[model samples]
Target: MTNLWSPITLGGITLPHRLAMAPMTRSRAKPDGTPGDLAPEYYAQRASLGLLISEGTQPSEDGQGYLATPGIYTDAHVAGWRKVADAVHAADGRLFIQLMHVGRRSHPDNTPHHRQPVAPSAIASGDSMFTMSGMQPVPQPRALETEEVQQTIADLAYAAKRAIDAGADGVEIHGANGYLVHQFLAPDSNHRTDEYGGTMKNRARFAIDVVRAVVDAIGPQKTAIRLSPGVATGGIAEGQDNDDLYRYLAVELGTLGLAYLHILYARNDPLLEDVRRSFGGPLVLNRPGRSRQQIGADVSAGLADIEALGVMALANPDLVQRLKTGAPLNDVRSALFYAGGGAEGYTDYPAIGIV
Candidate 1:
């Protein structure tokens, strides 16, 4: 029987267990977009997990959206991430840096240069985001010209290489969460008549191109991507072809021989089976709000090869040990998740058997 504690290999790296730490945006970086000192300790604390995916790190200045989130495109940022990579590796943990671009779901106040956000089309998320000042409306983003689109693809490739240089075992493209890639996939958000919009293949073009670029820069075996098909976050609506779009994406991305494809969804979704069959590679499923008892159900059922957890990994540094002993999980303070405090809610979460 497949168990959560069973060993597995991902992208040629052997893991002690099959539970991975899902990436969460903690807003813990410095104002300059470099990871703070506490970032290393925070990640190393949870190194007991089989793998740890870092928070949504921007690939470029314009890719940023929230306050204090880290970037991977600069020298200082690379230096900062090296510390994190060292810490996690010292604790015998594998890490993958997630590259996220918020696109239209951004406010100028939240960006370093106060630059206008860019998206697949000239449209706002029609939502607001948390800024240092307070909640601010997301302004309409400028649509990327064809040339600019190519540059954005190049930017992702460069960032992936930077992550490797910073000592990350791999990189996961943040194509989920209604970010830049999802914006292009969702019909309601992408209205361009150009080659990048209109048809399913065209809509899938940007994501495929970005993934190809990253894979080319940092071998396919060390590259991965996270995708959410039906999610409507950030004013995104997939319309009718959600399944077809993902089917095409699964097939296209599957051909690249990526490390793995991470899906954020409930296990009960029928599309899960479709995606699993379509991808034909190691699959990681992130099913939120699961109890300890349900941890390995997907793996045992042959639905997924690994399970990713967010709050559980965040609150329990020795999560694998706790799960083994069936220890009660520590509660997480939701209010402190994005508070940007040093170690109060970041690394202060005690492990099992600790006072």
Candidate 2:
């Protein structure tokens, strides 16, 4: 049986272990949409993982959703990310930047231009988001013009190139978590009659195009994608036909010969099994909120080539070591998950023998 520490070959990269640190929004970037000074230190500390997918970073100005999130289009953003990449590399860890475009989930206070959020249709999430002032209701986003849709895909491709230039191992398209790509995939959000919307194939087109473009920008081996099949997060709902939707997406994307497909399991939906069957390359499965006891089961069962972890990676920097030696695990503080600063909950987790 394959253990969590077993080696796995994902795309062109050979990982030392099947344990991958999942992409998480830290909200620690500069207000100008660039990674901050401590960002390097933060990632460097957790570089022991087989792979590190960075936080949800906007591909363009319009893609900015949450306050203090990072961006990758600008030279300054590239420079900021370069530091992070160098730090991770110095620690012998592989890093990939997650390119996210938040369609309708934006707050005016969070962005510099105060631009109205845009989506496939003029839909409002009816949700609230955190701002500098406090929590505020998310505004109704403007409908995207058909012509502008291609530009957004182009922006993602451009960001992928910038990520490689910044020394990242690759880039992952953030197509999950009710973001722009997921919004397009969900019928409730996308009602357009254009080529970019309306059927499962059309709805999947935008994401596929972004992937192709990114792969073209950076080799297919370095480009990856993340998807959440059964999730209805952030007011985006996947209808009853989710199985058909993902099956179509997986088959089409599999032909691209890109990097691994990372799936966040929401339920025992047959779509996950379909995706595993349809996708031809490596598949990384993320069991949301997984406990330490269940860490090795998925890999051992051959259900996933790699296992992605969230809070466990955040709370335990030496998680690999702890799991190997049965060391005491750190208790994560939910309150400090997004709190800014050093060593509070960020890097204060002691190693196995230190505590």
Which structure among the candidates has the greatest TM-score?
A: 1
Local distance difference test, each candidate? 0.90, 0.88
Candidate 1, residues 145-198, lDDT tens digits: the string is: 989999999999999999999999999999988899999888988998889999
Candidate 2 is scored at a TM of 0.97
| Number of residue pairs clashing in candidate 1, backbone atoms closer than 3 angstroms, sequence gap of 3 or more or interchain | 0
Model 1 misplaced regions, further than 4 Å: 266-268
lDDT of 2 by residue, 296-342 (tens): 78888878889999999988888888888888888888788778855
Error of 2 at 42 (Å): 1.2
Error of 2 at 165 (Å): 0.5
Model 2 local distance difference test score: 0.88
Candidate 2: worst-modelled 10 consecutive residues by lDDT: 341-350
